[model samples]
Target: MKPPPGGLTAYEAAGARYERQPYNRSGRSGLKLPAVSLGLWHNFGDDRPVATSRAILRKAFDLGVTHFDLANNYGVPYGSAEANFGTIFQQDFLRYRDELIVSTKAGYDMWPGPYGEWGSRKYVLASLEQSLKRMRLDYVDIFYSHRPDPDTPLEETMGALDHAVRSGKALYAGVSNYSPEQTAQAARIMRELGTPLLIHQPSYSMVNRHIEGGLLDTLEQEGMGCIVYSPLQQGLLTDRYLKGVPDDSRAATSRFLSEEQVNRELAGGLNKIAEQRGQSLAQMALSWALRDPRVTSVLIGASSTAQLEANVAMVDGPPFTDDELAAIDELTGPASSANR
Candidate 1:
């Protein structure tokens, strides 16, 4: 069979140093994560086509993006993304497992009934086991609670996280969508158990700035790292919609980021700033999130190989100038409105 377009054959001719992109320490841990990590969040779900999903993952890892982030409920049917990844991992990359950083999460709705979700011990530990079964892996590099379960006690969640790390099922533990207060609380609990809470994942972008409102400061104070999600604001921070949304674009078809909202209002100064840096709006948005040293990586989703290639290229560009920063700040105000 012919090699997949924009797939493994893109650089089959040369030896790879695998040092094109820089890596950062994941919190205070000895392991380092690449600046950009691929997320099996949206497009890896069952409803989407699978070949492109395979290509995106393969190309991403080939480009030195060793980290792959996943969660238990990542498919249209929930759990299908993990299953899909299992097939890919066993078929194409099992031998190189040591070279990869695999992560999965629980704490959201994975099953049904009372034991199905949240941060309870019964739920969190069971969910991680289910995830490992689906991914066909013995252990994940990191495991996280998908969200802060207000109903479940923080100690229960922290206990599950520490247990996962201690039992050799997960090497590290993290939390997502957590507030500064919750993070602080989790840290105290995890530190007492000797886990050291590796990182926090949050939805952050030039257009979505919720993490900036003290979350960054809190992370800095506590010495935790952050891996930001949706750095592109779905597809709003890309050239795909600058001239108006393309018919086949994510904005036009995606349920996560809507089309009407793009027509309503977007950070207007993005085009000018992106043009100044010779990058697409998406590239600029990724850079904006990574500009903060506290961020360990930007978790991005791409539906196709071309889009992934374009998004990854942003790392090679030059730094933003003072005037460029001022222009961007002036353009995208602090509304935190979704482009959708």
Candidate 2:
């Protein structure tokens, strides 16, 4: 089959890229991230079509999303997302790389050995080297330790992040799935090493408000930015499964979001409120997540360009009212039983 015409030329980013969404500064750093960032946790794997992934990425960039979040173990086959992105990136977005904020992470089970994962300097550095090679990049804009290593000393983990920046493998350092206390310790260590903690990636959503307990306050106190993942609660907060879980939905196919977790009663109630506000549940959910000033960006996953566009439209919706906010909490309070 013949390929689309002006294949590459068709991708000039929208002229109003900067005007599309408000960009917030990442903590005290000079870098500013878009209101919504694209997360490649799903849909970019080798299991999906490369053309689909490429199209979604192009649409996201065209809509002014500058940050692309990934991890070493993102794909089902592990590293396939980065490898696939590397191919499309080299072919299409290589020239526009300077305008992008590409981020990747480590500190998870990537390879099968003790040295293959965790916070030790050797593992952290080696993981990044492998990530760089897979992504075909000189250096990632923001590199993160995907999670805290309980056994690995905090100093060693923070030092590894420090080394990543000092060695020019990553322009910034971030930590994910860390608690308030752990974040405070990491910040202290990074400060001592002359590298401020750049950002914290945590799971936050209307249904999952675990970060609100104290982590948000800690990040603000530490002057670190926050880019939350799973803001959609793995598609639960959306209208996708309000009626019932479809066979093709992630809930049915993925282990992360199970069929039993789809609370239809909660969805029906939230959907009415969304309709009253003249918005979709997904749009309202995105807007709600971004309401906090501490959130630098809400990292979202999209399986198609349409979903990406719909998510970006979230910025245009009206802010929630006190009543609306209360209603959301009321509905989510029961459904928030899921582990963060």
Candidate 3:
């Protein structure tokens, strides 16, 4: 494999990397994850250069980020992200496999079949098999049922996750995008099955505060940790869009974020708060999401190593005070009151 743009021929992890960040336990479980985990939901597909993906992975691990999150349909062509990560793993990360907390989910549509999606036993188990093959790993540290299946019985879905751990296909089980009620039910079933749910992955940000309603309390009551994704609200919480959306920004290209949803005024107000706190908007957003101890980590995606470095630096920022929190809530409006 070719080296990344910097022209380095070999890879050696940083010696002081562990000292650079803190690792928090996942709920009451013994597993510990980096305060900031890297997600490969974007920029790891064949649409982007492989060298760039390799570079980001290297930079993340070097910065003491041991977790890499993914899903089956993450790439443009579907399954491309895992396939690409598998190739890079062979080249660089294979040796550090034991030191990594690799995770992937499978509750969304991936292939053209009745069993290709949802939370059925067949689909969930089969997707794990396909994911294992794509990532070239004997087992992932955590296997999640990406979303709850309304049509399928919750018992059957949770049963599949239990089987994944029993079969040695995954070390821990998790669920993402599950509501508080759904999470409690899933945790109950998983606990009954003897493979307790380890964590919950949700979309959370200064603007997207839905999870704050009851999910955090639910996780705490159930003794499960929370790992939030899209903590930057798809880049809206950052200074990138305070001026205007860039041509290459996700707001410009992806349907998930749009120019109409940019909210420059809201971002501007939040940026002021971030500046007062002596941090960038992106860093402040991350630190804010992690303010609650119930939150185990904030999962982030980066287009470049520099972006990754800047984000991981949030761990070093000072904690939010009551006045700062109130100011943030005031800027975010009523949705932020749900948690309080």
Candidate 4:
């Protein structure tokens, strides 16, 4: 559905929105994303209240969070997050279209048929169309191949992304969950196609530091920005799991984070470090992730405005000292060199 005749006037964004947040250029590209972007992977689903979801989106934009990330199968029932975001967009963000960086990905399972998933030209292109319809947008700012497909040729997958950009369905192309070698190959193909891979979205945090070994270097070589997801390790790096898994926490209800992986000993140590730095565990985790200049942005999922605000406030925290870095590495162990 189209936006209201004059757009929604009840909710006006803050005049100092840009002042509240900093922007970072996505690699060598002209695009600049907010230092901390909001991802609709968790709380924007149909299982959650629409009012809550709407509030988060409005708060994010008002705080100058220009980038909002999503995937085709993000919600509980699948596709609900995009649908909810689409509704919120029509009511709130329609007028600020050019000011936002809306993005979505494909390659994950969204349907049952052979063409339903993976990086095939058919699946990738078709999924983009579906995502656009669900999000009620003509085009997304960036479209990504969610993951690499062993069966489909790399050329076919990259071609789909190239087509997405060249056809105006997406402004730029990206990939996620790809290894260093796969990223290099994908970058090569997109560059040859004249579309150039713009970024890579990978899971990274204090505990999950696999990207440190090679992905960061590969992205730097390819001139592609790196936006990391799960910077909190699905709430593992936060104080939430310090005492024990809360009944309402992701560890209790979600498969992505299990109760068995709480690692209270590690979190307790990290929490102590955060306390010494005068910041919360979540804030310190985010600050730590952005400590690497190679990282362009960090994606955070929030269940409330308070959570979102606190995470965004990490930008104001003091920089990590050499001792702090060493302490963190000591607690979390050295970052693995294993590619993935």
lDDT of 3 by residue, 219-257 (tens): 999999999999998898898998898998899999777
Q: List the residue pairs that clash in candidate 2.
A: none
Candidate 1, residues 49-122: lDDT per residue as tens digits? Answer: 76777777878987788899999999777999999888777766787889899999998898889999989999
- Kindly list the per-residue Cα lDDT of model 4 for residues 77-124, writing each as its tens digit: 899999989988888888899999999999899999899999999999
Q: Which candidate, 1 or 2, has the higher TM-score?
A: 2
lDDT of 4: 0.91
Question: Lowest lDDT 10-mer window, candidate 1?
Answer: 5-14
The TM-scores, one per candidate, come to 0.92, 0.95, 0.96, 0.96
Where does candidate 4 have its weakest 10-residue lDDT segment?
A: 1-10
Model 3 spans with C-alpha error above 4 angstroms: 1-8, 334-340
lDDT of 2 by residue, 1-340 (tens): 2243324344556777777878999888899999999999999998988888889998988889989999999986999999988987887778799999999998889999789888888899999999999999999999998899989999999999999999998999999999999999999999999999999999988778888888989999999999998888899989899879899999999988899888888878988998988888888888888888999999999998999999899898988899998888887873363546
Off by over 4 Å in 1: 1-14, 263-268, 334-340
